[model samples]
Target: MSNLSSIYIHVPFCTKICSYCDFCKVLYDEKWLRKYLTSLEKEINLRYKSNKIKTIYIGGGTPSCFDNAFFEQLLKIVATFNKGKDIEYTIEFNPEDINENKIKLLKKYGVNRISIGIQTFNKTLLAILNRNSDYEDIKKKIKLLKDNNINNINIDLMYAISNQCLSDLKDDLEKIISLDIRHISTYSLILEKGTVLYNKKMPLISEETDAKMYNTIVNFLKTHGFCHYEISNFAKKGYESKHNLTYWNNNEYYGFGPGASGYINNVRYTNTRNLNKYFNGNYFFDKEILTKKDVMNYEIILGLRKIKGINVKDFYAKYKVNIFDEYNIEPLIKDKSLIFEKDNIYINPDKLYIMNEILIKLI
Candidate 1:
């Protein structure tokens, strides 16, 4: 194995912090921006192993917010990697952060994919999440990217916002479908402990309503020519997120920058989210080497997230134990919570909402 086919770099600076975000982030500062990119270059030089990389994803605290000079420098550092002819290089952008100049820069540097943070189209819901993009802004930005011939795009959406209703959700979906993008990732809001929304005690709608809305979105997207291939993602044919698929398939990759995580050589580790610690060259919090059982458990938990599920033959080939014998799945299948077909074991569509409970029993 070459050990470095995929890479993810986290850029932790944002122009405006969203109320619901708990990810490692800080408000953008020019001095810190220069220092952070320097440190990022150092970290990449030290840890990145394989020169031939295929899939690269630059995620954020709003990566697209970097000023043009710093943004070019950041791209220059990654360009050192030996890239394939058609590497799936992606960068996360905010809807308002992109313009003609940035679009040109991205295309010039071979960034083939763009993921936008357009959480919702409703005004009140947008304000509640502290997001600032509007319909016109997003539509224009999408056109800008496509006009530059960077057609691979993904947009993020959120539901279960404070005071959100089923009708509001359906309307959002209709607008999103009309955009004709390649990928969409929709998540239900979770009130993380330290976020502004959680501190303010923003209302999380009823579980019944949440369930209904989730089901509605799934059906709506399916009806609109999107494949609900993963739990929280849909895509047109041949446009699935290859970088994320690396994680779901349990493949190894590099995670760089503050608050990053990486798995290599059967060991999983998370870098420190502490900025000062990372700047001081202290990145890892700890590392855990997986035992056989631990690896199998991870395989099941992550693989089951996809619609195709886990292949039994591959499982036995990897672990030398039939999953049927290692863990009791027959009962789940019998009860209609899971299905075994085409030599793969998958969660039933109706039971996907309760996937956690079923996974608990499997583990």
Candidate 2:
């Protein structure tokens, strides 16, 4: 309702759940899919005020896993949006789920970006994560997407798995770089409470090793003509993910479907993770009506996730108060944990691994 320019739709159905995933998802069921699609449309109709959106990210438990019928229907529903001419429409895909038909359907619906969940190229690691994707198979899939003209692709690389070494990480990076994609999103494994890995008590690699891997990714990507645009994202020049930038920039966006979150009209809200609750017209689980101070806090926390950090002048203009006067960041800057250069403030690149501690000092 506040001139929102982005919308995120969550599809919570997967053919198989990964061992380390804790996202809201369930095994694919036709009846549930029908119901979910219906409920999603109703939620949008009830909540969305018909703003002309600039980006639509269809993220999921493998959004590309659906058959053409359901996928087309989903697209039709999304087509209701008043989209911009240059809108960035993205959908998440698993390598095994992508095919000619699905890629064609995506193109027909104006989806220009595809985010693939290829955690790693190591067969042993893939098995450990209960995911199935080999380099050869993924190469074929990427070729398929390109054959159809959807070239803005992002592949996810996950590191710090149990028993994963620096060599394994380097191998993964080499294969991913060879894929010639536009953007890459990297994630370090975190043991969530309800995931299969957590149930098995899977241990993560050492923190020191994890930090080394993070630095390796940053350095490797930067050396390969990829811009390290965010803490965990690398992109080719002019190919950054605008939908994700919406979150990092603390801009308002609509989040539809289960387990999604949105910010609008100074209120941050999350939809219920429970599908039954969502289907029963009980979409909202919780809402936080942010005060002016809370908004500023969010602006700092989210904006700093970008590698370039926040513009001090823009911050002052938005809040009508100087950030240096509000938070005593001088100590951090003095210690070199935070860097202030060219009217922008950011966490030191080397200390990005400990960004939380730096944030705690400021917030």
Candidate 3:
């Protein structure tokens, strides 16, 4: 079997565009959906090395927005993969797109994980981000998934919007915890260039407030029994996202569909975001072949993202080089900005907010 064991399929069609989103997406259209699927299947068949994939994440532009027939077809296309027996198949969804029929199909196709974009239960913040979801409606949807035995569920909770207070975030966390979901992915609102919020020049909450909110989330979730497994992810014990861990661990995986990216054979590549170009079969947009040094650098950068940090022995095993000899970690360790505990080297829990600066110094 090939070494690669994870797959991410991007379905770039959304029923509604959010003001803060700059992902590759367009309005849902049946015509485009049919064409996109055809190209996606061809790309997978052409590029996939036929490994027994252990995880498959169908993400982006709302994978749950499709009508019944199209959704089943998408699942059928994915079923062709040589999946492992205990696969963690996941599909991202907007809360409103979920229904009994879709849940049944997901159960039939063996999709065990569901990541819902419940980016705050506050009505005001929902309007600000142009997202449509009612708290009651969201609860009902969660119940539906659980009733169908699709219990490995995750909900996204976003914060740091303009004019949002720490109280607002606390309230959102309370509601989220009450849902009894297994995982929570938290994000601070970022106004990327070309996004509606960025174009409108929406003011961001101060860095000071943002940091406070992040700490609040960390503390609150910990009290509620969620393990802060990664920088932006928390889960009940044994419920962490295996697919995302694939990226943070800097392992190879397959990415199909427009705007998706994959790392294979020591090379990282992204497919074109342009639909027209994608339709014409120009699958590759950009690629970088990594040198040994390049790969090691990636190892440090991606591996450090996990809260547990990098295993020095694993680093040496993979690269045949000592991590400390290669980089200046002693200074950070001396300053308590990084912790070298046992065999693992991780960022200091207190200094995690400024991790970028520390990484810059080390890299």
Candidate 4:
């Protein structure tokens, strides 16, 4: 087995499920959370041999929703993993659940980064999305985080909601940026199957409007010194998300808990999604032992998400094969959808909106 430099712990309990979330999660219950955490510990010990983790990301239905004691215990178990002196530990928080006590616990556990799920400050949109926070609550939480020295914060924003206008999106962005936070992740609303929104037949913004909003976000963030490092992520210089970069860069990582997925030694595996099955000791949702072709294709798909794109020399070195010959991407290159320069291959900026179509041609 290869060494894992990154680890992801999924805590699948939320106080309430958002309308658009299809992630594996359940409503908060003390008994269920205890059982899940016990199983999660076992899963971690079973899969990982070393604790030398450079980065640890605690994500979930809402990690901060857990009780302070439970959160402390989880962090103590995580401490068993190989965490270096410079480990970048992050925990995702919902504004409704974040408090002074929770913030202190995060600091005590060596958490250096925090991602707040402040999708929007608009009360109407918050209600529609089933989010349990208001602008005032979020502002107070931000102050708490800052007071506790948790300055490495990232805020999530969503656009393209039904009836959402460009002006509304601009207001949200301005509010988030005005917080002086170093990073932001903005996503266009997608009505994924199996989510509450989809089941309720909720409407979404028109494709044309969504595209315009996305372009507006890119331009606006860039003007404010936030670099569009990934498709949906923007960050101030030197503040890019290191944990997520591990995934986009195609590095080996370990994932533990329900519905968590990981890639190691060219094999990708997902843990069981069923909480009962997981607690009963049945894990490993689905696994794929990828071939060389599978790896190459994945490299292309994931790498293209980054604006910096794939390094041609590094790709060739990793596979001991020429990328040009393997994918036959010259047609895309000729059409200006793909560009090859400086030993790197990337999609053209203008074609990023149509990345799927371009990737289909390459694959």
Candidate 5:
């Protein structure tokens, strides 16, 4: 059974590009946006299977960077799809881009979730990353969102920059927890090829420091009543991102835009990152149809990213192979890196920082 109930649309236009970001993005321009949205409509109408989409995540190049009229145009294009009763339409915003009018516009369009990209409250760090929003601006933007009744929000936090320390992260976390936000996603900075930071030869925080920071974040969030549902995500009660769960659970979804990756009919495909090529109607250039063994490997890797790990029974039912018999998980269990409890097998909380190492050992 193919569960293609989620849609991911990429708007590759940003008001300003962050030094650390490597996503397929360009500076904001009206002519390009109008053309991109038109192409987006064409791409969605061509690729989407017309399933009643339960979640539509409009990710950036800063989806909130436009004027109200242009925002309405983007909304109208997505409005072509059939939305479920409780649709989770989320948009990523930079605090500087958010205003009283755009906040209300999002509400009117049935957007229930907002993910703000406030990478850090540290002004010095913001300047280093080429970001404009400051801590005070973030506070005002958040208050504006709440006043307009759009409270299902997620705050993105970043760490492991060139000069960050454990105490700096502690300070950042304390300030973040005080914001009354529903969800928080923390990512260690990855200096990828082609990114300005990577090009500048910026050094990464030491492995020991990075691991310590990860542990601190998890323990701190747990104490504050946030469930560490996914490795990098924490949420209050039922606020886990429904759209992301579709991917973590290894289900099929529609990915429509330049640089979007999607799995459908057991084939994984990545759209071409070249915007000019995309605008000229070359949306996808790379795809792989999975074999049964490939699917099994993917399931093991993706499912394990969740805090609950994998359900042993679900594995047996889905692939008709005993998980223990198919692989040597018992070795990992013996090493205390993996834990099996309540019919679920998960990475040990203490070993989550080295989860990739454990997964490599398992698969």
Candidate 6:
């Protein structure tokens, strides 16, 4: 068995659902939350084995929506794992849910990182997207986090809304840079099926316009000392998210609770997305045991999502196979869609928009 060292817990309840979000979440209710926590504790205990966990990420449906008692109980359960050595612990919070009390509770529980959902600064656009926060609220929460000495803060931003002009995006970037946050994750709006935005036929920016906006954000962040570590994530010199890096690097991780997925020891598993099923102790999620070929293809697909792309040396060290020899990458290299240099391989700058196509060819 592979040594498992990373854990991800998903809390599937939110105070309000965003129109554009397709994540598994439900309208929050106190009674439902209490029952959910009870079930969550049982799930954790059921999955707990003597594995050395190096990182723990409490992602959500807005984990910060939980009250102090629930948060404390959840942390107490997680504390059963290793701590105080070199572990990185993170919790995702919605901007409106953050407060002085919550920040204090997080610090008490040894949470070293906070990922805040601040989709946009424009109040009008936020309303259009049905996101629940104003600029003032976001600012206050960010200041509170900083005042509480929460150093590693990750801010989430979005672009390509129906009426979002380039200037609006610039203003959002300005507000974000003004905070001097350690990390930022920016994503283009995707109208997933079943989302309110998709149902309403919200307009997405044209391909050219979206590309320009993306490139602009990248250049601006780089000029401000934030490294574009991944396609959607920018971080200062050493503030890269270790928990997320485990996923990008294809390392083993265990996921618990509802709607959480994990890749451990080359086997990919997903916990049940249905909250009721999980609460019923079904653990009815799917699993895909990856073969050697599956792993090699997945490494290429996932690694290309990073701005620095894949390190051929590290790939060979882990899999004992040269990546180029394992796949037909020559056509892409000749077409200027892929680049190989300094023992690393990455997608060409201009062709990053078509990375999926290039990866499809490789696979």
Candidate 2 Cα lDDT to native: 0.93
lDDT of 4 by residue, 1-363 (tens): 444699988889998889999888999999998898799889888888785788899999789888889989888888788778888899998877778788778878799999988888777887778886576667788888888888889999989987789898998988887788989998777888998889989988888998899899999999999999998999999989989998888888888889999987888999898999999989888999999999889889989999989998999988998998898788888989999889889889887899999988889
Candidate 6 segments exceeding 4 Å error: 1-3
> Which digits, one per residue and each the tens of the lDDT, describe model 2 over residues 43-146?
99998888989999999877877788999999999999989999999999989888978877887889999999999999999999998888998999999889
TM per prediction:
0.98, 0.99, 0.99, 0.97, 0.97, 0.96
Query: Tens digit of lDDT per residue, candidate 5, span 1-363?
Result: 348889898888887889999998999898888888888888988877678888999997888888889998888888888898988889998888789788777877888899999877777888878887677777888898898888999999998877888888898899888888999999999998999988999888899999898899999999999999999999999999999999888888889888988889999999998988999999997999999888888988999999999999999888898889877899899999999999999989888888999989888
Would you list the C-alpha lDDT of every candidate in the order shown?
Answer: 0.89, 0.93, 0.93, 0.87, 0.88, 0.85
Which stretches in model 5 have alpha-carbon errors above 4 Å?
none
CA RMSD, predictions in order: 1.1, 0.9, 0.8, 1.3, 1.2, 1.5
Q: Which stretches of model 3 miss by more than 4 angstroms?
A: none
After TM-score superposition, the amount by which residue 213's alpha carbon in candidate 3 deviates from its true location, in angstroms, is 0.2
lDDT (10s digit) by residue, model 1, range 273-363: 8888888788897798999899899999999999889999999988899999999899999998899999999999998999999999999
Task: Count the clashes in each prediction.
Answer: 0, 0, 0, 4, 0, 0
Q: Once model 4 is optimally superposed onto the true structure by TM-score, how far is the C-alpha of residue 108 displaced, in angstroms?
A: 1.5
Candidate closer to the true structure by TM-score (higher is better), 3 or 6: 3
Record all residue pairs in model 1 with backbone atoms less than 3 Å apart, i.e. clashing: none
Which prediction has more favorable lDDT, 3 or 5? Answer: 3
Q: Rank the candidates by lDDT, best first.
A: 3, 2, 1, 5, 4, 6
Candidate 5 TM-score versus the reference: 0.97
Cα lDDT tens digits for candidate 3, 231-257: 889999999999999999888999999
Compute the lDDT of residue 225 as modeled in candidate 6.
96
| TM-score, cand. 1 vs. native | 0.98
